[model samples]
Target: MKRAVIGTLLATLAMVAHASTPRDLESSAVVDGTLVLAKNGTVQTVQIKDEARYGKPIADMVRKAALQWLFYPVLREGQPVLAKIDMHVRVVLQKAPDGNYTARIKGATFGDMDAKSTDALSNAESNKRIAPRYPIDAARAGVQGTVYLALRIDRSGHVTDAVAEQVNLANIGPDSALRQFRDEMAKTTLAAARRWTYQVPTTGRLASQDHWTARVPVTYTLNDRGEANPDSVWRTYVPGPYTKAPWSDKSDMDSVDAVVNDDVRTEGAGPALLVSFHQG
Candidate 1:
C-alpha cells in the first residue's frame, strides 16, 4: 500500500507538471506570510504578515492553503532543523459568475520583509486595478490559484515597474506540475498590472511619498469543475457593485472555524485575522 500510495502521488505530480505553464495570463495574487517548519518538513505554524490591507478571507485562505503545503526544508549537515521562513507567494484565482470561488497554489518563494518596505505599503490604495484573464489552456486543464506580483509605484500612483516574481502554487501539485502553467499566468498578470494605478504612498502627515514597493495578488477560483467547461475551474468571488459580501463581517459574535482553512466563518463586520508573522 505504501508503494501504491507513493506511486499514485508521483503519477499525479507528473501529470500536473506537464500541464501548460502560464505564460500569457495577466492577473495574480501576491501573498506575504511566514511559516514555521518542523524538523520533519511539516508546517508547524503559519501566519500572514499583512492582514490590514485586505479583508479577512484573503488571509484565511492564504494560511489555510499554507497548512496543507509541503515545504522544501532547511537542512544542516544533512539533517533537518527547525526553521522559520518568511515566504512571499504569488497566487492566481479565476472567478465564476456567482462570485463563489476556488483556487490552487501558483508558486512560493522563500523571503523575508524589511520594516521600511512594509510601512511604505501600509497606506497605499488601489486607484485603477485590472484583473487577470483566465488562461484558456489552464482552464481546460483545471488549473487555479492566486498569482503574485511585485511592483514599484511612483508618487503619481502609477506602477513604475512590475515584475512577475512568482505564483503561490502550494496547492497546485507536489511536483513540477505547478510550473507548467506559471509563465502563462504570469504573462496575464503583467499585462493587467502594468495598466493599474494606485494611490500614492503618503506620510502619516498625508504627504505623498516618492515611491513604494507593492505586492499585487490576483486570484482565480472555481467552485465546481465542469468537465465540459474548460474554464469551469476558474471559480472565485468578485463582488459586483450591486452585491454584498457572502460572509458577514458585522455580527457581534463571529464564528471562526479552523485558523488555517476556508471553512472559517465570522460574525460581525470587521476584517478577518490578518496578523503579522512571529515565532508562532
Candidate 2:
C-alpha cells in the first residue's frame, strides 16, 4: 500500500545503538523523521519532519512502516519517559527477474546514536573507477546522493555481478519527478558498476582470499555551484598502468578530469540528512 514517508526536521533522533543496519533483503528507501513514544516505550505515532516531498503515496508508506517499527521505550531512573527523537530510516528496493519491484527497510539512524557506527561505508579506493555521467533528468532537478552497490569480485578482479544496492539522495523530494529521475539514475549507476574491474592482489596482504564479495558505495553530488560542470573534481588519481581510473584520459596523465563535484567516478564508489533519503 502507498504510504507517507517520514520527513526530516531540523530536529534530531536518539535511537539506541544496539540495533544497526539490516544486511539482507532488497529495496532502497531511506527516511528521516521523529518518533513520539509513550512513557512505557510504546510508539504513539510518527510525524514526517521534512517538507513533504511526495504528496500521498510516500506518506502512506511511511505510516505503514512506522506501525511495524519496534522501538525500546526510553527509560530514566528505571522508568519509561515520553520521548521525542530524530532518526533516519533506509529501505531496500528489490527487483526480481520479472522486473517487478518490492521494498524493504534496510537501515535507520538516530541523530544521537553514537560516535561509532556499525554501518561501515566502504568506498572502493584501490580499484579504477569510471565516474558516471549525471543523467540529464537528475541533473536538471539537482538530485544528489550516494548509490550503494553489492559487488561480487572474482579472483581475476572482474566484477562478476554488480547490483544497485541503494540510493541516498538528500536535497530532493520524492515526487513523481524525483522518483523518475532516481530510476533513470540507478540504471546509469548499475551499468557503470558492472564494467568495473580491479587489479587482483596476487601477493602482498590479500593472497589468501579466493574472491572478494563486498558492498561498494558510489556518491553523486552536484558541484557547489549547483551545476554539473563535468570538471569540478576533488581527487586526482595518478596516471599509469597501476592507478588509472576510467574517468581519466590517458593523454591527460598529469591532471585529474573535472568529472566530479556533482559526479561520481566508480573504481568502486560509494551521507546523511534527517530529511531526504536519496530515493524516497
Candidate 3:
C-alpha cells in the first residue's frame, strides 16, 4: 500500500508539473479591432476591419465574438456625464509545424488600468506620504499583528491624511502592551503619511469633495522556516506539506471533523488526548 501511495503521489506530481509548463498552440488566428463608445451613451460601434478572419463573414464573426467594451461616466455635481473611450481586442491562432490547426479563440487586452497613462504620478511620492508613523519592529519576539489604516487621495495629487481604522493583535496577549505598541506605531506612521502624493486627471477639474479611499496591508514577520530549516518554530506552527492524502477518505474531511469535535469533549479524554477517528 505504501509503494502504491508513493507511485500515486509521484504520478500526481508529474501530472501537475506537466500541466504547469507552457504549451505551444497548434493553430492561431489574430483578431484586432477598436471599440468606440459615444459621449451621449446612446451610440456604440466596434470597428473590426483590422481584425483577423477565419473564413467567416465579418458581421457574423463579430456578433459571435466575445469582444466587450466598457465606459465609466465622468460625473459632474453628483450627476452622470459622458466620457469617450476606445478599446482594442486581439486574437491569436497557434498552429503546429505540420500544418494542423489546434485551437481558435479571440484574445483580449491586458486591462483598463494597464492601458491608461500613469506617468503623471510617482509611486515613491505616494509611498513617502503614506509611510507608517511608527517603525514596526518586525524582528521583535511575539510581534505578529495587522495594522489597517484608511487613506484618502485628493485631487491635488497628495495623500491627505491617514486614520487608524483598525488594529488587530488579540493573540499577542495583554491589552495594555498591545495598545502601547499600536499607539506608538500610529503616531509615527501618521506623520509620514502626509508626504504621500498622487496624480490627478489632467483634463477634468475635480472638486474638493472628490477623493478616493485606499487600504494598505502591513505584515510583520519575525522568522522564516520550511526546507531551509526543519527545527524552525515558524514552519512548525505555520502550514506545511500535507502528510495525509487529499482523497484518501473520499469525503469532506474538514466539514466532517468540524461537525464531530465542535465542543464535545469526554471528561476523561483530556486536552492532550487527540482522538483520531474517521467520519463518513
Output the lDDT of residue 264, model 1. Answer: 11
Taken over the whole model, the C-alpha lDDT of each candidate is: 0.48, 0.45, 0.35
Q: What is the lDDT of residue 47 in candidate 2?
A: 78
Q: How accurate is candidate 3 locally (lDDT)?
A: 0.35
Which of 1 and 2 is ahead in lDDT? 1
Model 2 gets an lDDT of 0.45
For 1-280, candidate 3 gives per-residue lDDT tens digits of 2556434433443343223212321122223444443443332655554433434453345434422333343344656544333322222334466956444333232112223443122244336435442243322323333344445667675667566444433123233444555654455555765575555434323232355443343433333331111111111111111122221232221211111100111111111101221110
Order candidates by TM-score, high to low: 1, 2, 3
Candidate 2: tens digits of C-alpha lDDT, residues 1-280: 1212211211111121122323332224345567676765455787765526423455566656665555555555657677665554544455566866555454444432222322222234543547676765455445555555556667766778665544544443324433454566667877877776655444422345665544445666666576643321111111112223332232121112211122222221111222322233
Model 3 lDDT, residue 33, Cα: 44
Q: Best candidate, TM-score-wise?
A: 1
lDDT order of candidates, top first: 1, 2, 3
Q: In candidate 1, where is summed lDDT lowest over 10 consecutive residues?
A: 257-266
Question: What TM-score does each of the candidates earn?
Answer: 0.39, 0.36, 0.34
Name the regions of candidate 2 deviating beyond 4 angstroms: 1-129, 203-206, 228-280
